[model samples]
Target: MIIIKQYVSIFEPMKKIVVLLIFLAPVLSAQNYTIGNWYDFKKGAISLTFDDGHPSHYNTAIPEMNTRGLVGTFYVNFLWNNSWAIEANDVGHEIANHTKSHDSLSYLSVGELHDEVTAFNQKLENDLGFPIRTFCYPYGNGGESDSVMFYIQDTVAQTHLAARSIAKATDDEHYKYDFALSERDYYQIRTVHMRDSMRSYHEDFRKVISTGGYMTYMFHTIGTPGGWDNMEVDHFTDVLDDLLLIKDTVWIATFRDAICYHRERKTANLTTVYAPFENGNNWVLNLTDSLRDDWFNHPLSIKLEKPTEVVTILSAKQGGIELEYTIVNDSIVFNAIPDNGHIIFDILNCEIPIVDLTVLDETIICTPDSVRLEVNYDSAYSYSWFKDSVKLEADSNVFFAKDSGNYFSEVKLNGCPINTASVGVSISGVCGVPNANFESDVTRQFKDEVITFTSSSTNLQGTETYYWDFGEGSSIEPGYYGPGPMEVSYSTPGEKDVKLTVTGSVSFTDTIKNKIVEIDDFNSCGIYKEDFNGPDFKFWHWCTCKYGYNYTMEFVNKALRLNLTDSIYGEWDNFKLFFYEDSVMKPFDFSDDLYKPVLRVRAKASDTCRASFSLLDTNWVSTAGMKMNQIGYIDLTTKYQEFELDFSNLFFYEWENKVVDSTAVWGIS
Candidate 1:
């Protein structure tokens, strides 16, 4: 016995049985069947055909088809001649006929139809030396004065060949004949046409093939339309490429070849059972049987009840044969012919759970001294710890890590791996100190001037140890040991780098360049130059007193008697005065205030270049026998413009006048 089963879902369980018969002959290969006969086979088949002898049949269609090693039938008309018809003789391509004028066959009488088809056939045979066996209705019509059905039957009988028309096939047995033949009651064939660019056609092709059934694709012209019924060449090539990729799983052949192959290969001893389970249903079962051979033997029926059910049907070839039953599920049971060959069903609702991990707290900057890691999990039963790739012994919810590395954790549920998460840890330490210097021209002079040195450092987190090297071969003040302004004396002139080393928790050092100091000692004098005749000489005296030089003289000013006193020195010590009024000095008594004199004193010496001083007091007396002396001198001559006096070292002094009564040597000089 042979049996077959067809299920809606491939997931359903199926079974088959094979029994060897006595005196069976072994076949080596597939048997060849006659051209027009039907064949029965384990799997269904279909053929793809094309029509309309458009120019693309050669240029666009053939080359694309050569890529996939596919060939199709092309029905032509006389209008597509040497000027328009594809050169069919050049390639092993078929060319059939539409009418010579492409007139609707339904409008023509049977005799005229015969003349139209035969004339085109004769033209093709004379040109290509081949008999045309196929014909397509122009405008898809097949009738003339008679009904299309009667016309198709008559045409087939007259031509001693088959004919094909356009119709779709369905599983309904009532429409089987209409779907099977070109005309209602004739042996004519009917087929479906598929355009290359139609998405619906590809989807239908996939659906039919996936159902383990027949699928046919039909095409017309293979290029841009010059008339109706046209398709692009590339579109045709794309379809062929798609089909070739699945050629192993699909049967691709000519229309006539497929019809004949399916008819003769049909099996009577085999049956198929289809069982489609409802949505969310837990179980599905299928059973099949093959009485002829194991290759065709398969389970054809599937049973599905909540707990258990025994399903049976009449054997396709025999009756009253009981198959065995078995308990495969807790409540579900199945039956099979052999005890051990029964189908088993399983309905498991298993799903993988999702796990998510997150950090609850914001991350903190990692340092060499401290680090903390915090994390949280959702839908996670447990976790396995890891650092880098090495697994840690403890699998805790959170981990505190101080070392620098990649930290990861694997989640688990009931000891099964789920997902993993990771974080990176980094470490850092404290910064260090920097240095200072200075330049100057003084080395060792009191000069009453002061210079200072500053200290600096980096990463001084707290109080730092400041070591100041002043380059003076002396240590800093006992109490001063940090960054501050401090004075040091350089009695000589030079350059120096003050080094400051700041050591806190972190140690650092820095140096500052060219701390300079300078000192000098020089003296200058001032004198007055007068342009007077040389031989005629006059005596002039210059003096610098505390206030200035004083000489008493009488003067009359407009009915008033005025007494004038000469003071030579200015308020500052480094100045000199010149007495150049009337070009000469008038003789006057030194002991008595009798000589009125003007004195000029120029600047004598500078006090440290950056120093100044105010006059304290001044007095004037004769240069004779008065024992009066100036701390510095000023000469009245052309070369000595002014007298320069260094009173910076001078202290306070007093002088008095002395005279002999008789001759008066202290008289005017």
Candidate 2:
């Protein structure tokens, strides 16, 4: 409300002034409504938990906590004398399962893990009349195997509300301050050991306060001469005393209660309806959630900012029942039960109308699938959707998004705009489709030359099968899988076809026709020709004698030129130009030919030099070792010239009788 005072006139006799008073209507202001991160809107949270069913826990820890009105979660193994579990449950503390044998779940088989987890749960239900709500890994070891992790996430998660692990969450360095309430894995909740120094605990508490996160302490024994991670009796009492100092701002709870509140608040909804009364306004609060009410009945703390200073009187009620609330620092704070009944509030001398808005879906999704983004819908308020700060055409309360982006919504009420938190959508998956292709080592070669076929297929999404065919009259080399490099040779001299078929999401087949894979007769001179047109080193191999040095070999002027600057073999170094038929040497036969075969070479040299040519056997040994075999030698001049060393013209082709036999030769050098 606004008040105005006006001075009308001033008198001279007694300095009297006439004043006029004016009052105006109250001005409206914006109000913020929020749900506290922790119970009673605490700054941080701590969960006290013990494991291994140590006698010190019941003997020393529980009694000490009971004196301070504190509760803890105790994970007990059935192998020990766990009859004290019922006594722990009788108190306000939580009795959780730590497996029957307390073995590392990662080293256990699938069936053994199932028995270990379910057996403890069954025993707890029979003994305590209720099964365990949360669990702790025996040695903070959930699993490192996919099958075991799957069982814990898919199977064990069904029975337990949440699980705790001493393993670091996300990173190794930040284990002390494990997780914030907004981003924690409920199935694998992270914890810190109690043996860490009190100074470390203080630092962790500070981190929790700053981030509004939860820190869980894992304790095994409470006094000296006890089990693993034992804390002295005095030290344990000091820890409890330290927690009590921050009791107002830090909510210390049992494991089960903490998990229940976190899961409930994650999907809760709060709505406020405003109306005008005689001198003030009325607000009807509706709080609801989507989880099962039987298990998730924990109350959520709500804070409402006072809309105007004129509002002096505040009262709350829910369906003929008075709801207890506090006016702290000029704001109304209360714990409201979800889906119970309407909570009505009456405020006097206030006229502002309030609007409530909240997002319904999760903010982050980690799959390649799409998720629906929804918000609370109301007929009195209009909504506008935006993606990545760009206005979308959607005017409804729900938006179905498949692309990856940041999505948010705006609600317009009483000429004011309110923005809800944004939901980040990320889509991830493989990117391409399967394809099939291949290439042959060479397009044309001799009949006995080896040809290698290699597959150039892409997007082989594991589980695809492959097949290759080198066509008729082809001999396949061994030691290769489907679509792998296959070495094959064409025995017949005609053209042959090669095909590769890949069977997957789409059946793909590629074929190289006979024209592309040509094989000529080895007896023809056409099989032995090298124009040295380009830098393609497909068939020839040049060797320099061991003592020769300072030599260069390259293709120039459409011919292969070898320049030896110096030689150590008396200027008569053995220069052998060997022909490579694919990757292996194959012998060709000309013993039955009507005419004798000839070895020809076009050569030149910077200085006077002699070259020798001979035939090697299948084992790459010189055939000239025998008395009947002979070699061809020639002298080269500076000018390029053609030289021929023809086979001696005599029947039976025996060099001892000056005759030739080509069947024993495998390579020319």
lDDT of 2 by residue, 1-669 (tens): 445664321112111232424346432322577788889988877899998888788889999999988889998887334446666777779998788898988788878888888766877777677657788878777722234465564445656767887764343334333342432266667777786244466666656677677878888877856467778888888888888888898889999888777777876777554442533456666777755565566788888776564354446877657878888887788887776787777655622224333545444333444567777777766788898999999998787776779888887655446677777876532222335678887886556568888878664556656666676778863222677677788888877776666555433333222225888663211123545333222234333444433333333323332322223333443344433234443333333233344545544443545443344332212455543344444455544455665443322333444444333331222
Instruction: Note each model's CA RMSD in angstroms.
Output: 45.0, 30.0
| Candidate 1 residue-wise lDDT at 501 | 48
Q: What value does the lDDT take at residue 235 in candidate 1?
A: 67
Model 1 C-alpha lDDT per residue in residues 407-514, reported as the tens digit of each score: 777765555454455777654334333223322233432222355555533334455565656654333433436676667654434443445545554434443334
Candidate 1 — which residues are off by over 4 angstroms? Answer: 1-42, 79-92, 143-148, 168-188, 210-215, 225-227, 260-669
lDDT of 1: 0.42
lDDT of all predictions? 0.42, 0.63
Best by lDDT: 2
**How many angstroms is residue 299 displaced in model 2 relative to the true structure, after the best TM-score fit?**
1.2
For candidate 2, list the clashing residue pairs, or say none. Answer: 653-659, 653-660, 654-659
Candidate 2 ranges beyond 4 A from true positions: 1-31, 79-87, 107-112, 143-148, 169-184, 196-199, 273-282, 306-315, 318-322, 346-669
